[model samples]
Target: MTKVTAQLSVSLDGFYAGPRHDGDGDWMASAESHGFFRVTRWVTEAMSWRERQGFAGGRQDVNSEIVAESFDAAGAYVMGRRMADGGEVPWGDEPPFRAPVFVVTHRPRERLVRQGGTSFTYVTDGVESAVAQARAAAGGKDVAVAGGGSLVRQVLRAGLLDELELHVVPVVLGTGMRLFDADLGLDEFEGIELTPTRVVPDPQVTHLRYTVHDRTPLTLDDRGAGTEKA
Candidate 1:
């Protein structure tokens, strides 16, 4: 079985992309050490999807372990069009992702092939279809929801996501895309559980994991241990 999980970095203010994201780079641009490019490169190299997608070298810096662990069991990846460079830059020399990369978009484009083992597969259909295809490609491994926020929101809104892994960067951009900014009624999710995690710097930046219980509502005794119901 394949699981769908949304994983991304967020700021203290709960924003993923800043107001100037359109003009500037990404939301993490204003933070120290950024970890923007670093994270992207790390994610690509981390996935089992990388075997067929694309990858670039010159990385292997800090945070490699966590990056590697993310996809140690991942089978494939999916993301919104914005996450696909917004169809801008042609994913040139060192492209980031390396799985059976599925891009959700209404626009039509030819299949994209890149360096270091990667190819782009565009899906015009909705999230469910993408999840199905991703699972097929994942080969029993987990499916990761790559995001620029919109895509993750769409899946979450539809109650399609089963998990969420967040890596928080301690910064107060005050304005940017947020992981859960748009109201996604909590009721839609059953057995919603959250686990708090901290790294060397504690709150400076932390990694959290959320798991959704089966769709049906459950009683208190039905809740699993180590899960802080949301």
Candidate 2:
């Protein structure tokens, strides 16, 4: 089965986006205005995905490669209603997804077909159902949870996510939307059961990959013993 994965760019202090991001164009403007864009510069500055939206310059370096790999891994996407609505501004008529996107929302709307291969299907049935629909639409490829924070938290809390890739930026947005700001008591889970599988260091950000297993991961001593030469 294709892994249900999520990728997000978060600040060192755990903020994803700054406050006041209610589908307004300001969210994508200068960082001085929308602190969210400041943290997300890693993705927006390097990825060719920005070019698809009529942006001028983008990188082809390590960061861009990482971004490209993430894009290639997804056959379908699941995002919250805010992400879908917020994206319409910067994304124009042909959003960069270029694949089927299932949006989780309380308000249902007709399927929206955009230019390029992107299509938006609203789901009022919640995260699991949205994920199910995204996976089916994805065929055999991975269903990527492209987030706006709240939806990502919901999926994590539900234990539906198989992998979580966090691009940890160095900056700290003191007050903003946080990935673990929900009332789920995530403090009780981090570094205990959520095991880090890989860590790729970059100049601008660090890519931290974790696998969500049913039980806690091995301790340092256990891992050392498992790697001993026979």
TM-score of each: 0.69, 0.85
Residue lDDT tens for model 2, 1-230: 78899999888988887765444354446443366777788888884656656778888788888888888889999998977876777687888888999999999799999998999999998899999999899978899999978888788777888999999999878887788775544454353266899899987999999988653434454657668688
Model 2's lDDT to the true fold? 0.82
Query: Cα lDDT of all candidates, in order?
Result: 0.65, 0.82
**Residues 37-112 of candidate 1: C-alpha lDDT, one tens digit per residue:** 3334334553333432354443343344566666565678888887686533746644545567778889878878
In TM-score terms, candidate 2 sits at 0.85
